[model samples]
Target chain A: MRKIAISDGDIQVSTRQLPPEGPEPKPITPAAKDWMLFLGFAATVLTMPIWLQPLGAAYPDLLQKFAIFGIFAIGFNILFGLTGYLSFGHAAFLGVGSYAAVWSFKLFTMNVLPAMLLGVLVAGLFALLIGFISLRRAGIYFSILTLAFAQMSYNLAYSVLTPITNGETGLQLRGNDPRYIDRAFGVESVGLPQTNLFGIDMSGYPGFYFCAAVLIVMFLIAMRIFRSPYGLKLRAIKSNQNRMAYTGFNTRPYLLGAFVISGMYAGIAGALLAVTDPLAGAERMQWTASGEVVLMTILGGAGTLIGPFLGATIIKYFENIFSALNEAELASAFSFLPPPLQEFAVTIVNPFVGEGWHLTLGVIFMVIVIFLPGGLVEGFRRIGRLFRGRSGKRTASQAEVQPAE
Target chain B: MDAILLQVLNGLDKGGAYALIALGLTLVFGTLGVVNFAHGALFMLGAFCAVALNEALTWEIVTVDPTRTTAWGTPLEVRQPYLEAQFGDFGAFLVDFSVPLAILVAIPFMLLVGVIMERGLVRFFYKRPHAEQILVTFGLAIVLQEIIKSVFGANPIPQGAPDMVAGSADIGAWFGMAGSIIYPWWRIVYFLFSVLIIGIVFAFLNFTTYGMVVRAGMQDRETVGFLGINIQRRFTIVFGIAAVVAGLAGVMYTPILPPDYHLGMDFLVLSFVVVVVGGMGSLSGAVLAGFLLGILQSFASMTEVKAILPGIDQIIIYLVAVIVLLVRPRGLMGRTGIMET
Candidate 1:
C-alpha cells in the first residue's frame, strides 16, 4: 500500500492507499470536501445553543460572545497563522470598530448593517495606517511596533480622546442625540435607542442568530482565503520571506492586505458587540484584549481554518460557564464522595474555577504550546492516529517536518 | 531651572525603574535567546517578597486584658507584632526596614525561581520557534499573576518606606538653586538603588569569567558548546541573575507604586517598549533607551509640554519607539542578524 499525504501548512495526515481494496470508489472532489466541512461547521455552530446546554453555555449573551470572539480569532489567524507575523495589537482594530459602530449609532442610525460597515471601513483604514508602518520590520520588531501603536491608541482613547471616546465612562447611547438617519426617516425616539436590522430588535436570541450568521459568513471568507492562490503566497512568505523576496515577490502588499482584511474582521466582530450592547469602551483596545485574541488563535490551532473558532468557543465557555461556578456548585458536583474527601476535592479544584478560570486557561495554554504547538486540532489528530493504529511511521515522518528553531 | 531639575530628577527616578527591568529582560534575551514575557512577573514576585516578609514580621499576638474592658463589659483584646514583642526596638527597626531588606530574601528566592523556570520550562523551548517561546512564557506569566492574585486578593498592598526617609527632602538647597525643590526621599533612594544594581549587573557581566562565557555563548552558542564549555549552565545562571535584578527593582519600587497582582502586566508592556527601543538583546542599549524614554516621558508630562500637545506624556514612549523603529529598525544599539527576521 502507498501513503497519500494530505497537508495543511505544517500539519500532515497520511492514509494508506490500499490496492483495489473494494469496488472502484468514485473520487470526491476537493470542493465537495470543502462543502462537507463547511456544512458540518455550520450545523455545529447553529446547534451550539442546544449541544452547549449541558456545558451551561446555551444562553444568548454567552452565545453572542462565542460568535463575536470566534470572528476575532479567525481574523487574527489570517495574519498570524498564514504570514507567521504575530501582531500584538489587533485589539486596536476591534476597539476602533466598536467606537466607529457606536458613533454610527449616535450620529447616523441604529441599523446594525450601517454600523458594521462603518466599523469595518474605519478599522480597515486604521489597520492600513498601522500596518504600513509596522510591516516595515519583521519578527519581534514587528510585534513591538504593533504593541506600541495599540498601547498609544489605548492611552489616547482612555485619556485624551474623551471628546470622541467619552474617556473612562465609555461611549454610550444617550436619549438625546442627532441620529440623523433616524430623524430623517421620522422614527421617533421614545427611549434610549436599541441597535436593530430593519426594525428587528437585535437582542437575546435574534442578536445571537445575527452574530452567528456573520460568523458563518466570515468563516466562509476565511476558508476561501485559506484555499486561494493568494493564501499560497502568504504560506510561502511564512515559510521563508527572504526566499520569497529573493524570487522577486514584493511581499509588503500581500502582508498589508492580509493585515487589513483581518482588521476588518475584528472590526465587524467589534461592531457586532456594539450592536448587541450599544456601548463601546477604550479598555477593549488594551494589550490584554489583544493578547486574548492571540491566546484564542494559538490555543485552537493557528493555521487551521476551524481551529480558531473552536478555540474561541472553548475560551468563552470557560470565561462564562466555568467562572460562574462557585463553591456551592463545586461541593454539590463532588457530593458523590465522602464529606471530607469532597471538601478536599473542592479545596484542590477551587483555585482553578470561578474567578480563577484564567488560571486554568493559562495552564492549558502553556500545556498546549509546550506539547501541542498546533493546538487542539493537533491533539485531536494525535488521538485519531492513536485509534487508527500502525501509524507510527506516519507520525515519525510528521515530526521530522515540525518547525524547530 | 529648578523645575527642569526636578523633572530631570523625576525622569531619573522613573528611568531607574525602566532601566532595571529592561536590563534583566535584555540579559535573558541575550544569553538564552529567549524572550521572557514573565520578567515583569519576576519583578512583581520580588515586590510580593517584601509584602510576604512584612506579613511574616508583623504576625500579631493577641492578648485579652480584662483591665481594659469596654463599655459593653467585654475584655479588650490587645495586639502586638510578634517580632516587636520579642525584640522590642530592634524588631521595630527590622519591621521598618523590611522593604529594603527584602533584597536579601528576593535575591536567593528569585534566583531559585529563575533556575527552576529555566530548567523546568524555558530550556525545553530553546529549540522551538520564537512564537512558541512567547506563547508559553506569556501563559506562564498569566499563571504567575493569577496565582499572585489568588494569594493577595487583587488589592494593591501598600508597602511603606522606612520612617527615616518617608518625607520629602529639599534637593534644591543642596544644588544651590534659588527656589526650593522638594522631592520624595524614597524616590531618590529608589533611583540610587537602581543605579547601584545596574552598576553591579554591568560590572558582573563585563568583569567575571562566568559572564564572559555567557557572553560568548550569546555570540554563538554552537561554537561555545564545541569549545568544551558548559555554557548552558552559565546561561541558566545568567537567567537567575536577571531574575534577581528584576526582583530587586520590584522590591525597591513598592514604596513608589504599591504592589498589586496586575502590576507586573502594567510594567511588562512599558518595559517591552524599552527593550525594543534599546534594541533587542543589547544590554547597554536597554539602559540607554530606558532612561531616554523615561526622561522624555517626564518632560512630556510637564504643563508646558501638555499645553503644546495634550496627553503627549501618555504616548511619548510609544511615539519614540515607533519613530526609532521606523527610522532605525536595528534600534539604538542592536547588532546585525539577531531577531531581524
Candidate 2:
C-alpha cells in the first residue's frame, strides 16, 4: 500500500446528475494499435540486455527472476486491477501451483509441459474451492477471508504436511526423485542430453527464451481479454455491483471466472518458477508475500495492462540488483574518492545495503504509498499532463482537479 | 486423558491471548470504523515494556547492618539497598517479580501509548477507506517493529516467572484435572489475571456512563454528534482503550512467549481471524469466537482430525471460516450494519 499524505479539505464536489450511460467501450482500437504495442514491447525486450549485460555476467539467474515476478504481477492485475476486487489469497494459488508443478515433475516426468499443466490445474482447483465460499462476501470481508486462507495454507504446509511439503527444508530433490520423461532437463534441442525441448536438454539460454516467448503469448492473450465481452462485464461489476445485478446478470459466475483465471495465471507463474528451480516452499503463500503482489500492482499501475509488469521489474530490480552492493563493492565503486570519504561511505552503508535490503524495500513501499497513491504509471501520466498543461493543452486530470463551478 | 487435559489448559491460555488482542481490535473497529492491522504490535510493545522496566532497576550496592545478630548470639549482617534512586523504586521492585508488576505498569504506559497512537497515526485514518487504513496501519506496524528491533535487537528476551509462581501446580490432589491438567503456575496466574482484566474491561464498558456514551456513539456517530457531543474525542479515547487492552494482553503474555519484535506478526494473523470469526465490532462475539476457535484448534490437532486428514489441525480454523462464510456471510454474530461502507 502506498502511503497517502492527507489533510482536511475545504472542497467537496456534488453532482447534479449521475454519469450518463456511455456507448459500449471501443472494442478494439485497430490492428495498427496492436502492431505498435508489439513494437514497443519488442524494443523494451531488445534494450534490456544493455543494462542487464554487466550484472547478467555476475548473476544471470537474477535477471530471470524479474521476468518471472513480472508475469506473476501481470496475472494478478487481471483480477485486482480490472475487477476492483482485491484478493489477498492469490499467493495461495501460487504456492499450490509451485508444489503441484514440482510434484508432477518428480512423480510423472520432468517434462516442463506436463509439470506446468499440472501446476495450473491444481491451483485452479484450489481457487475453485476457496472462491466458491469466499466470493459469497464482498469488499473487505472477501479480502480478509482470502488472507486467512493463505495464512492457513502456509501454516499447513509448514506444519501438518511435513512429509509432503517437507516442512521448512521444503520439498527438494538432490537427485533421488524420478524424472522419467525428461531424460534431460527443460527444452533445448536435438539430443543435447542435459537439456530438452519437450525432453531436449534445455537448462540453457534457450529455456530462458522459451519462457520469454510464453510471457509474450500470455501478454497478447491478456490484451485480447481486455477488449473482450467478459472483460466488459468485469468492468461493469467494478463500476456498480447492484447495477449489473438489477440488469439481470448473475455476477457470481463473472466473479468466479475472474478469480479462477487469475489463479491459473498465478499457477503458471509459480510452475515456471518451480521448473526453473525445481523446489517449492510454503513461504510463497505468506501474508507478506501477498502484500508484495498488492504493492507491485499498485506501484506499476493496477488498472493498466503494462503497469504490473513494470512494477514487478522495479521490485525485483531492487531485491536482486540494488542489494548486491557490499562494502568492497562500494569501496571499489568509489575508488576515486579520498580514503577517509570512501571509508565513511563503506562503514555507514555496509549494514543496510546488502542484508538489510528488506529495510530499503520497506522504505520504498512507504514512499510509494505516500506519494504515488495511484502508483508509478499514474506518476507518468501526471508528468505527461504537466507538460501538456504548461503547453496550454487540455488534460483530464486538470478537469477533475479544477471542475467548473 | 492427562495429555488432553493439559492441552485443554494450553488451549485456554492461548485463548486468553486471542481474547486480549481481539478485545482491542473490536474496540478500535467499533469506534473508529477502521481495521487496525497493527494491534499485535501494540501487544508486543506492552511485553517489551516489561523487559525495558526490568533492565532499568539495578541495585549497585548493598549496605550491611551488624546489629541484628539474634539467633546464634553472634554478629549477623543484614543487607539493604541504598540506591533505589534512579528509574523509580517501583521499577526496582518490579525487577524482582517483573512480569506481574509489569502488568501493573503496562496499563498506564499502554494507555499513554494508546492515546498517542490514536492522536498521531490512527486519527487521520478515521476518514480513510478501509484499504488505505490497512495500508497506513500496516506501514506503522512495520515502522514500529523496525524501531523495536533497532533498539532491543531481534532475539527473544528470556523473561521469567516470579519465584512464588515459578513451577507447575500439583493438580492431582485438587480436582477433575487432578492427574491431567497441571499448568505452570505463571501460566495459570496469567490466565486468571486475563479473566480479571476482561471482566474489568467489560464492566468499564457496560456499567459506566462514559462507556454508555461510547457505545451510543459507536451505534450512531452522526446522531451522537448532532446531540452536540464531542464524538471524535470519544472515538480517540476508545482507540486509547483498545490500545490498553492489546498492551495488557502483551504484558501478561511476556512470560509465556517472551517478548520479541516479530512476535506481533505471528499473533496478528490468528487474532485478526478471530476478529472476523467474531463478526466485526461485536465485543462478546470476539471473546466467544476467540475461545471457540482456540478450543477447536486444540481438539483438531488432537488424535481426532489427524486420523482423517493428517493436517486438518493446521488449516481447520481457516476451513471453518470458509464454511462459516459460505453458510452465513455475515459471520456467526455479524451486525446488520453495512461494513466497508
lDDT values for all models: 0.90, 0.75
Please report, as a residue range, the 10-residue window in candidate 1 chain B with the lowest summed lDDT: B171-180
Runs in model 1 with CA error above 4 Å?
Answer: A1-24, A391-405
Q: What is the TM-score of chain A alone in each candidate?
A: 0.91, 0.81
**How many Å off is the CA of A402 in candidate 2?**
18
- Write the residue-wise lDDT of candidate 1 on A153-260 in tens digits: 999998889999999999999989899999999997688978899999999999999999999999999989987889878988998898999999999999999999
Residue by residue across B1-341, what tens digits does model 2's lDDT show?
67676667777777888888998898898888888888888988988888886664434554444767658876665543433544466545556686777777888888888889888767776666577677667766776776687679889997877777888997654765555566788778877877887898899889998888899998888999999999889888888888888888887888888788878878887888887778888888788888788777888888766898887888877887777766766557878664732
The lDDT of model 2 is 0.75
Q: Weakest 10 consecutive residues, lDDT, candidate 2 chain A?
A: A3-12
